[model samples]
Target chain A: MTFLSASLEQSPSTAEEEAYLYLQRGLRLCRYKPGDRLIPEEIAAEIGMSRMPVREAFRRLAAEGLVTLRPNRGCIVAGLTLDEIYETFEIRSVLEGLAVRLAVPKMDADAFLDLERLLDRMERAGQTGSSDWVVRHQEFHALIYTLSGRPNLIRKINALHVVIEPYMRFWFDYVDKPLSAREEHERLIRAFAQGDALHADQIMQEHILGTAPLLAEFASPVRR
Target chain B: MTFLSASLEQSPSTAEEEAYLYLQRGLRLCRYKPGDRLIPEEIAAEIGMSRMPVREAFRRLAAEGLVTLRPNRGCIVAGLTLDEIYETFEIRSVLEGLAVRLAVPKMDADAFLDLERLLDRMERAGQTGSSDWVVRHQEFHALIYTLSGRPNLIRKINALHVVIEPYMRFWFDYVDKPLSAREEHERLIRAFAQGDALHADQIMQEHILGTAPLLAEFASPVRR
Candidate 1:
């Protein structure tokens, strides 16, 4: 029931929770693209549940900004405007900046190993042009933020990532791979190793801000 | 309904919206203090409605971290551990720091005048030991952050403020007035006026962090 991240590791305890997770994963992975309508009955039949849990899931997703609930119409996948996409990146910059600043002091050898593993996975995904690259990209940042030990801050930052992930997926799918992204993250890891919180904070903010304009420009042509 | 802030300016469009706002205001203002059980029937009676809307409100408030929804026990006002209080302040420090950093460039003669007016009202509320002081204090900060022109970021920051305001009210109610709060804010305004975003950011973060230990200490004895 925790909306902190998109992790599917935990099993759902309730039908509504199950429905929510199913729909959320679908939305996050761009299975339900922006402007797609979600019919409660259709989703309920698909999930083999009554319509009520699906309706409740819609409300929860609406609260999370993952979907829009219309008065008479059904739920629609929430799309960010070009401006909204940039605004989200700006917000994520400051929040994830705070994350790495706090995280650097707490990063131990184990955390560094986990970071390296995720980096390796991302590089592999990038070479294969696998969609898993976007997910690994997210996990790499999530791993760093989780070390901050501030659950509330990490939760808020992860929610932003959830809202913006589809757009990121869209950018990666249609546009060319970011050639500098790996280099930037490598520099970021080096900065983290230095244990300079402020320096790491700057690097993290710039790392997030670095992707904003590229996504904005790519998303501009396709408003949906 | 907008979960932006505790603004009662707009009329509610639905029964659920009405109940949500009422409960939100009560929780934020400490009318229903931490750990208080909110019975749907009682609140529905007070609002002249059925229990359905009140229950819906409980779900929304639960999503907001203002209340805990036990499976069989209904809703209870959420109580924070001492660690949570400190953690929230740290989160607010960075978010509000970003706020002022963005807000400085947007400040103008009119905005300065508005800030002075709110400060005046806050001073009067403090002198009278009026409960309105907590509200005015929120307004002062909200005024600055609103100038950020980033609605999503502002919305997220305001949600954190909503979660922390009751504790602030508890501190001010039980402990002495912050004698230096006004002076600290004055210094913040001066920093903002200088248009040095980094300095203003630092001041804002420190100003928020400055209050954390004091509130934590005061709330420690009464972990209700």
Candidate 2:
């Protein structure tokens, strides 16, 4: 399958932005595994771009903690250790809980409908064992943050999510039962519909933390 | 004043680590104000180092959101806006609250004594109107995190503190009354002594959030 979508390729911007997005997509899709060296020339060639833009993308990704740049060595994808995974989810629970509490009181009927539609999409994707399920699940959470009226909080939450995405993918693949995903989403939707902000907050905290143990089991020691 | 202490200068490591600590100290002391362009050669000359180490320091600082590295141009100190100030404190409250709850149950008698000593130092610094008050105050909070036995959480809390340090300096300067600082510490200490983890958590959350309004009033629009 092609890494770059036609729409992303056709968008107007500097080469750096395109390259950054290209590399980000590849990382998200696990096209580049953790500790894998990223050679700028090869990436630039694959995307029909120059090495300069790809090099710039490497620096940007490094800044975001997605990659590490060694002095004499090239850039490599960053890995999360067991402790780091627990740390990431611990923060995620609090931040996402705050988002739910802030969003529920302000959510209107249309917002509820949007969440329902996204939940439906996630359910279908899960039943079919489609990779797009994770994408839809992220959108569902992102929608809740967008309704909260705090763009800064959303940015911070998204950053934490990006760092943990690969491990999350690992968890999804190794775990046989995908049944909990749908049930949890349904419970959250019900809490939102009832206008129970506190309950929704608690559910979010538990939902995020519930996966911690399973993910921790799969985490390997991070390579320095 | 000399930017680097004798110990820091004499310590063994790569040029990059030394340069990073030097720049971090400068930023913390407000030697480099927000929006000030950082010239690698000038910093290198001041520290008796080369431009390469200074350049690496810039990249590390940028990763921490402490500086902005503009393409084609040089790096500049990053400024916080009103919204960012509020957001930082919001997250700080939650994380610090978590720290207090986690630390209080595990704190030993020696830990309590250390906290008391730090509080005493802070009180003295406040009464004398010494600039070292913030340093002591940060140490007091850091001690609490250290006692919690969670190094990862401490690192995350410290990262948030670094981003907000300059604005905190602004807040400390513009507000003359330091009485609240002492009183708040006393209350937190009392809660810890009583072994009331939940109460300590609440006090921490309130203490951090209480300063948000005053700091928000002093924040300027971030320079693009």
Candidate 3:
């Protein structure tokens, strides 16, 4: 509610945070389309602020892979080429698989069962088949990351998450079948519960990257 | 030269890029130390610009991992932890390993000679033992990314490059000798000439994580 603000009136810390908030909201709502011109004055006006903080927000968003900085050309709203998307997911699949591998030795029975609860919640969320549910499903996987105890790895994984946001949005736009994604999650949960790191790694890797691009052609020049 | 300006002029693009340049310079000089405060007026004043453009630059820098957004606190210069350094180098080592592996099969004799020339230049640079030469030596390694022929991978690799800057500076500060790093470069160039992917990867992996607070007793806190 707070950090993920819909408006920019009063962010807790500084003008920069407020600036970042407006842009984050814009990105989440698909208001700032891929390859859109991101004018500071426009964003600042939208958030009922000046250009100061919004400029700051743009910086973090760039780091998050939502914006690009080029010479001659300034910042543009960033989109993943199909190649970048594939690369991002492939790298993430291995890293998450690594996380899952690390988590196995540390996972207790309760943690296994807790994940089941998340799966069920995701299933329930899927009944509405809302974008909200997809986000919740993403969070469920993030919980698995928490068990791994590697903040360093987690940061890189988060970067990948940001990189693919738009394509994920497009995927949900066309795909009416929620059951497939949910099914994938259920299968992944089962693999994790068995404490089979190799299988779990392979399963999760496929679950994250294999299916994501197949839902649509991410690398097509038209998307660029 | 235009990008080097600290002042934000009346023009929008000029102002915005000037802002970016300010932070970039600040980062280069370590003026914005990890955890340093980022006040809009302060930045604007120092850059000889209005708060608006400086705000814009802050956003860009935050995205680049040069600054941290503190919710209500505004922007603070971002800091790199030792753990982050390790994880970053680990990922870079893997990606670069992948890069050179891809490049190795396709490396023409001319390219092999090019790699040798780069190494020789670096060795000559290393013999002079100037920090500036060492920095350029680092750039010689970076040119390998472009040879990989994957723009997306290069961007990711470059992102990794920015993330490691502060820590690498710390590393240069600590190491008593520069010759060993240069010698490793020579060995690496030879490995690349032989099309030795495994050996190149091995040397690179060591070359990167070599900064691992390997000597446990030497793991002192990074004093501000």
- Number of the predicted model whose TM-score against the real structure is largest: 1
Q: What lDDT is reached at residue B13 by model 2?
A: 66
Q: Write the per-residue lDDT of candidate 1 for residues B110-210, one digit (tens) a residue.
A: 99999989888988875523568767877888888899888877877777777877776667778767667888888888887788888888988988898
Model 3 spans with C-alpha error above 4 angstroms: A1-19, A38-47, A50-63, A67-76, A94-98, A101-105, A116-136, A176-207, A215-224, B1-13, B38-47, B71-75, B120-136, B177-203, B214-221
Model 1, stretches more than 4 Å misplaced? A1-6, A35-37, A70-74, A120-129, A132-135, A221-224, B1-6, B31-48, B70-74, B120-135, B221-224
TM-score of 1: 0.88
lDDT of each: 0.80, 0.76, 0.65
iRMSD, per candidate, in listed order: 1.8, 3.4, 3.2
For model 2 the local lDDT of residue A44 reads 90
Ranking by lDDT: 1, 2, 3
Q: Residue B13 deviation, candidate 1, in Å? A: 2.8
Task: State the DockQ of every prediction.
Answer: 0.54, 0.33, 0.38
lDDT at A220, model 1: 64
Compared with the true structure, the alpha-carbon lDDT of candidate 3 equals: 0.65
For candidate 1, the TM-score of chain A alone relative to the native chain A: 0.85
Rank the candidate models, highest DockQ first. Answer: 1, 3, 2
TM-score, candidate number 3: 0.73
**Candidate 3 lDDT for residue A28:** 59
**Residue range A25-115, candidate 1, lDDT tens digits:** 8987778878889998999999899987787677678877888876667789988898889888888888889989999999999999899
